[model samples]
Target: MSQHGVGLRAVMRSAAFLTAGALAVPALAGCGSPDPAGKPLAGPDTAPAARDRIADGGTLRWAVDAVPETLNAFQADADAGTTRVAQAVLPSLYRMGERGRPEINPDYLESAKIVDTEPQQVVLYKLNQQAVWSDGREIGAADFAAQWRALSGRDSAYWTARNAGYERIERIERGASDLEVKVTFKRSYADWKSLFSPLYPKEVMGSPDAFNEGARRALKLTAGPFVLKKVDRADDEVRLARNPRWWGRPAKLSGIVLREVPREKRAAALTAGRVDVAEIDAATAGRLAPHEGTVEVRKSLEPAFTQLALNGAGGPLADERVRRAVARALDRRELARVVLEPLGLPAKPVGSHVALSGQAAYADGSGALGGQDTKEARALLADAGWEPGTVTEKEKKEKKDKDKGEKAAGPKKDDDGSEEADDGTYIVGEDDKARGDDEELAQDGKQHLKQGGAPGAYAPKGTAAPARSAPGPLAKDGKALSLRFVLPSGPGSKTLATVAERIRRMLDRVGIRTEVSKVEEEGYFKDHIASGEYDLALYSWPTSAFPATDARPIYAKPVPAADGSLNVEQNYTRVGTDQVDQLFEQAVGTLDEGESRALLRKADARIWAAAGSLPLYQRPQLVAARSGLANVGAFGFGTPVYEDMGFLKKEPGSPSGKASTSASASRS
Candidate 1:
């Protein structure tokens, strides 16, 4: 909450980390570093050289992907946008430090420590004497108690997204004075720093009604270095000004403005002098890095990774052998090649769910999936009672009949004797020849592999395969091995579509049929994926500083609702194994860092054996900033302190100078 860094994409990026609880450990070497496949991890330099002087005052205009649906970061609908906004206006007790560990922020709290762990885990926090809300209310133990009750999962009406570590809290009480707060846990929690992170005021967390309604509008009272000045939904921009009542060090900038910009237009926006900073991908970075203009590209390896989540509760994925077979058939290396290599990036596939490639505790366990072996895949399918020969004959006959039906319903001729499109979707009479080098789309229109456009632009331009060879259609008891795959179809969906198409091809090679479903981007996570509506899905999870505790909700068993329906919060895969849950608790309860790391590694091995998901690769966190911008860059593991961010002041009408805000509008 002490505005560590003000990033428009923080909300979306932080959304991936909301699934689980948090744990703790001493500071260690950072997790991310430059890899051989790419350039040194680039981003804004948080720690600058001594000779560089910090600027006093200026306005910084930045770009964000979308407008936030709500201002509350605790709500179920909160996303990256929410976190970005919250960072400026909320009170974060701790921030991720340079050592990739949680560092207490002195701006909000004077000190915090583990006072006792004998009878119950007790943590004491001393609030700064000057720390008070915009409403002039002192931050106290009541606010802490209110937040714990709202997020503890004790009241179903709260509608919280996660309650993993919070439910273990026993009580919250005031110490000697209103400035002191003591929190007692029912159990010894290692990741206690994750709690009350962006501590909310009692006005917001006091009741279910307040939690629901207060979040719908802009925050009224804030305690951070910056305060929300304006939220222009009409123009897709949020404006913040330095908080006059803030007791901490005065913010260097007079104001900060965040504009909502599309992914494709960010580079252009930075080039056109419309914004000061923009986050670009590797392809965009390559294009802009050579330019010696005012713009500079900063890149860092993100702690997040992408994956194909296979549903374990129902459908073909319900069987563990089928899931393992699917994992074996698809070459993850080939996947990395198709997705990352095109952009001249690394083609290494991530192997663990809990740890990323560059983390200190990282280890690859994907070998348990047996590498890419179509032979092994077929054998697994055969062992699961699915016969390849019989299913192949029936599938071939069905395709033959379907092709005849499609030819019979061919396009109609116009009055000019030109053939018209059959269904008025695609134009006919054009060349239908196959592009041998290009990837083909699936027969069901659900998947595409070619690099046509971003995610949803996968249109098949090549001919279908002449023969169903490798592994014939897998069938058992008159049922074919068919799975449904759902992906987003909005702002950032182009890559997802491409990945989904490639996966569809891999599954097809092992005689598994996949039906691809496209959902709107806004509802992709909340409506489709989180609801468990697909047999398979594509998504990413952000790793937390305390990964062992934070991953509990993601791999934990689904808690049941009062009506008996599955109430899955972050465990979208629906992996309900008691062993995974036990391992998570053991890791979280372990105080020794080495023991915790070992336990987490064991848990990850179990996850791979389950075969519900295959980690693809670590995503690169890239941000483009104009030269002279200091204290604002890509933070690999920690939040950027907003108060510390400023640009080197330039004379009027200079080439690389900061400017004031003008027109504000949303771009698709």
Candidate 2:
């Protein structure tokens, strides 16, 4: 099952409720300036300003969904959207480029040089005399040491796979102001520069476990271009003021205010001149198309890819044949056209586990599966001895509906009134066996059948019904098959559901079954996918500034957690092969990018052969800004360049300016 992250439906609903409530309630007599329409206002600007108010001091209200659970760099749990907000307040030593490459920035670090490279090792330097925190403490080697120990030691939740390469560290030597950190891998470790970034202050972090608590309270001690000035967790708002002590050039903007807004309201907020910028969903993108003079849409690439992960640990999905058949049943092209293309994006169908850009150096051949082909799908199922009636005709009907949008009921019942329940509770024309007998046998007397038929009565032996037989052969029912697809409920989830419905229709025409179940947000991650209790799921692989080559852990055999449960993030697919593992190891050890890409390609092919995940599409980070907002630069999933923004001021004779307030509005 391809797993997309949690949908934003709930968040959007909350936003709607808040907006509605705010509109329904009467306003106070005077809170702020009134609009030209003479209405009590929420903020200063009546119309969205073209150029930013050049004032030296004031707040710039920004918006985001949620705040981080921890401030510790090693333990931080933030989504890409949240990370983009944090980047403005926190500095990373190395910044990511458009092609997923990294480069050092002098603003944060005076200089970073590779002092040594030999014998399976490399050493680098952190200039100590150059930088300082807002509290006037010198930023130096101790901060680096503290950061490394904290990330590599315990409490490394924030230490992504990118940090795992640092485990080869041999020693750390400190100079008066500079820190010399040396790393020695058991074998040659590729992408060493990708390993370490800027280190956090040790004086503040103190210990690993205490880092989160300390950072939360010490929000004012950030070393970046901006400093946290106000944090209202209850209201889902945060404000960051310019850091006067920042080592870099002074920020152009005075401060940034981040408010958590729902995805649905983002487009309207931009159009109504309430918010300067926001991320708009694909469905809403169309509404903004006509307002080109007032809006600018930017399309960029992201490391994120949408995929369907198959839980092969148990159930009917245990068979690779079934998994591959399901992959063949999907119509990715249709999904891209009808579902994604409307949003002004393109979809690249891939069978490989690794993304197209990140393929290993050695990989050349295509992935294990190809694009949708119903005939081939039927052949695969036939070879696997799968029969049509067993899975349910709903799958076939759903698949057919994708292309034609025809609403067809599931399999028709015989005139004798022998039809199964839609819930899969009964199998028509089966032997007379009591319900729960197999369950009781499986549990070994843990559950007993009731004696009477009142509430929980078990049928007597003579009256017991036979176990319902599995659905009939697909060959008998036009080769129809039924497959279940699970996804999280949210605004983003609706897109996944549409895609699921499309796939269902396509497969139904090809003799396959597809059913989508939208699971609850909190329970979905823990009880569903992690426990191997799902059929298929849609998800994404969130890449970091330094993406590692540790794909094996996620696709290999399941790894049991410390509490004896399984780690869903790792290997839910239950696919393992010595060849693929070796390729992953080789790619990680290879220093050259070309070599690594080649190896990754090979590993991707092997993963495709295993049919672990069906690649659907890649997700892009989209932000919609009203016209007059300038200097908007997006750095992948990193941070938005707010300092660069300048409002577009309308000319005196312009129609818009005549009806709106003066161009010289002050910053709030």
Candidate 3:
């Protein structure tokens, strides 16, 4: 959940609800609109039924945008698909409950609790003794120790882009027996539960080479209810067969085929009975209402949100003013309306980067800088010496010279579509709906501009500001105000493409020109988004239940490691401040929920000031599944319990799955 869209298939944080070779949609709804009076936070819409009432030995033809690039979630190339694959095959010690809290997964964990805080933090894990990997290796201390070594960041050889809680690990050892593990921490880690959720085997993590590249190729060993059977790349599918050695409840379905079906083809696949379960966009769901008997579309907001990520590593955006200028240029509220209004949900922009609107910790951090104001954007650009109506002959010639023989960036790969990949919100074609810039520029209110330094080596400190009267491309030192906007192209990326196009027009009005680059989905996150090869990108990241744990990596300052490699972890934007890092450190170390929320709020404000990324709105979870499917569909805050998913038993003499009929649940 790169592009967490720096995407979530999130588990992609580590595996997941994500489908990532192409990028993924992670299923994380950090905070939600549920009332405090006991309503389910995720408001899960999957049809619930007792396991005994569910049919067994059925196959779930799942539609995923892409298969995982790597089986290991820790690998640099791993995406949300990596996480989603692990969801069924790997062992996660803890899973997210509907309240957006961690709940122990009894399949692998018996109990996990903090036993000490004095001197050093320590945690004791009680694993289920019955749990064993496919090859008869017990799921115990070896696995935990190996994983800690691989992910703890002590060894630079291991390619772990995200080492959140693992970085704080001091040591991991066997507790009383192989079934129990004792973990000691170098620092206080309030979100320790976040670690080792989708635990890999000792065989996979025992060595750096195996840890780094082995998982990307094959995870021959697994312990979950389902095990790896085949990765049918020719068919764009990852197939899983039920594990015969599973000790917990037998998986209700015999196998799950995660097929790569394009978003546009989703409805047809559903109607044709090709896919039993799939995630769809609001438009797709809207079209399915007339034929609700074929599939029931469920909707909910996920823990993740989509955003406009600014690359502050270099170019014009290195200046916070330009970043904020771009932020103010877009109409977030209207964008939210274009995406979410289709679902009959509230169409307000998500206010905080740290939390969703309905959650208790949620607070609007966007206003600390200012609201949507094209006028302010123009002023900020002008103050930075990129005055409107001032494009010099040199700039004009350069712009013309750069526009020859343009070609698509690369052959397009199938784009992964998850709420995470949707950048979490549609932010789609408000085409004719794009706000008229001429009208917006005429507004009287002028936001206070926090003027920032010019881009490094762009111009001297006191360059004369040109007259800012008319509208035209801004220029500074003979260079026009422009940015490289990288976007993904493929079936699942229509929303992302539309949003990018719309954003292009919005920036155009404020004298900022965006050079659009369309790249293959396979390299979108790895080669572009994560590599910081573009000035601006729009994507989604699944917000975490543990904000301090997850958000820290995404926003932490890039530091130099012993190997001299920039240890960015997950801070793909290449922009961070010590203040932001310190706030997260304080928040993660602070165990009290209220205090942590306060610290995170401070961090969110700093992030807004940094203007590395702008949270747009909650990405709605739109899942369409054949009727009678249970325990899987639009899981909001709730992590799927893979074993419980299946077709409901034909009620006595009910019709088969193809003709199965049911109405959609009440909108959560």
Candidate 4:
């Protein structure tokens, strides 16, 4: 097992990736970049600060894409917003450190260490006597046991988001005292510390009904610095107030307002003092240049990569050759270079879907397939029965005639020979709202233009009627083939829009057409991408430290359940194989680092071959913050110390009042 426990939040992030659109994998070790841990202030630029130096009671208006659909992070429909709120209000026994290692939260546990390896793996945990839930219940072994039983994957009735580490746990017992927890595992799990994170109370975990929807909209029990004050979806915010019953170091701020600001408005909100911190897009970062000293654009290498996902459950993408054709048409390398090179980071196509460039297990699995090749792409499409011409010779000629009058209707090429859309900022998220959890998924993944015209398509925003070209997408058996390219129209999506536009042009050259659907950022991941409502979509996946457990579900093959529906798990692409599953299982069971890496590499290769998604590049993690603020920014792998977050008080004679950046606590 990996030294760092790739436990709950680790698996939660992957499962959440299905809902939230983040897919950070397991095991991260790197250099020069902030993606890897252990470097000085490089990983997550939260601007560390001592508890005493921060000004004690300022409300921090934080920005998020949307308020979590569920307060329960373990629910299948929970998103990154759930994780955000959970980090501040719930109990994570071990939080991720700057270097991707899991460290104990002494506020909850006095110590947690492995006690045995033979017979059966066992871990001993000593709980903090003062650790108690918001309802005054002691945080005890009952909570752990209840959580294990609910998420152990043994019961199909629970509807857990994932059951990674729990499935291997044989049992959880109390030892010596009620505060002492003895976790016995059925196997050697390297990422043991990953479990018990964002730990829930027994009241919620003990019952299947409660675990399903009880905490979906509200949390009755919380054990962290902040408590749920309100979930105002109407206002697009999840408000958190300071927890008076908290036993740890007092939170420096009075409360946190997790406000949902569209990516486009986040910059204005920050400038107007409506938000103190926000994850800004590249263009937003650039736009904030004039406010440099006052508003700093903090950059961190996130454990995430943006990719193009192809729905393989039905339609043209269901064929492997067609999927490969789509992959070969796009110039991922050029896209990465054009977007990230200007940001001062070394830009290149993120080689592996399973791991980012900085991780020790990172490998270029897409290499054997070769780079973007138009000739090869056309060949693949033709071979797959997608004829090079349109549905009829007349349609092809009409398209050619229409092309003569227009400028070929493609992305405007910039002066540097690079493609540019109306804007340029990148955000990794879904593009529509969600429906019922158990509703039938969009297996064919199709969406049509239902309104007057595309709301936020290629044309500039506010265009009453944008031209939506409907030229014949190459057809087979007289059926026109086209993919619904879903994109987000929100605060920080200039980059996403640009990428989508370029993809459309590339595919157009090969006689493939796409219908663009610009959707709201709020439910994009939950409703559209994960639900397979779009035949083709672009989104990002955050990395995790435990690959076997965290990354497995993302690529695991969908299997038929007794309910007559395919239990796709987190493989929302609805495509995977037994070979990948076997590799992930072997990696999860192995304690040897070298062996695990080899298995993951093989799995990644198979994933690339499957062509479910094309890894594009490392998503840019740009956090815009007020200079005086501390303990918040592009967190990368580390979770924020919410209680330690606050603004700095000015020094006695310092005119600039900027010593605050340096006031952060020393790196561990």
* TM-scores vs. true structure, each candidate: 0.75, 0.71, 0.74, 0.74
Residues 147-213, candidate 4: write the lDDT tens digits: 9999899999999866778989999999899989999999888667678777999988988889998
For every candidate, C-alpha RMSD to the true structure in Å: 10.8, 18.6, 12.0, 10.8
lDDT of 2 by residue, 1-668 (tens): 10000000111112233221122212212336331112111111122223344324434544455554544444434343335445676556666544444566566655555555566455555553546777887766566656556555444543432245555555555643343334445456665654444345676455644565666534556677787787667866666778888766566667776667765566566666555666554445555788676666655434455567887776556766666667676776555444334444554443345543432221212334555655666666666666665545774575467535423543324233422111101110011110000000011122222212332245565676654332333553354344567765532444555556566666666565555676765465556655666787765554333323445466554557899976545665665556667777887777666566556656666666556676665454455654544445223433344454444445557786422422322144
- Worst lDDT run of 10 residues, candidate 3, spans 434-443
**Model 1's lDDT to the true fold?**
0.67
Prediction 2 TM-score vs. true: 0.71
> Which candidate ranks first by lDDT, i.e. highest?
4
How do the residues 1-668 of candidate 3 rate in per-residue lDDT, one tens digit apiece? 21111110101011121111222211222366443213332466787778997877678888876777788777656655677788889888777766566678888888888898888888999988899999987888888889998888888988886677888888899898888899999999887877887889999999988887777867889999999998888889898889999999989888888888876678778877778888776656755788786688877777667788999988899877788778878888767755666565556777677766544446666655567777777877776668755757886786676654333342233333322223222221111111000000101111112123323424568976655543687878877788998876543555666566668878887888898887776567767876789998876666666778767778889999999878887787888888788888898997666677777877777777667888876777778988778888877777788898887665766655443442121000
The worst-scoring run of ten residues by lDDT in candidate 1 lies at 421-430
lDDT of residue 174 for candidate 2: 68
The regions of model 3 sitting more than 4 angstroms off are 1-42, 67-69, 129-138, 154-162, 177-179, 207-221, 230-237, 262-265, 282-291, 313-315, 357-362, 374-494, 501-533, 558-572, 652-668
What Cα-based lDDT does every candidate model obtain? 0.67, 0.50, 0.70, 0.71
Candidate 1: count of backbone clashes, pairs at least 3 residues apart or interchain: 22
Candidate 2 scores a C-alpha RMSD against the true structure in Å of 18.6
Tell me how far candidate 3 lies from the true structure as C-alpha RMSD in angstroms: 12.0
Candidate 4 displacement at residue 424 in angstroms: 8.4
Which of the two, 1 or 3, has more lDDT? 3
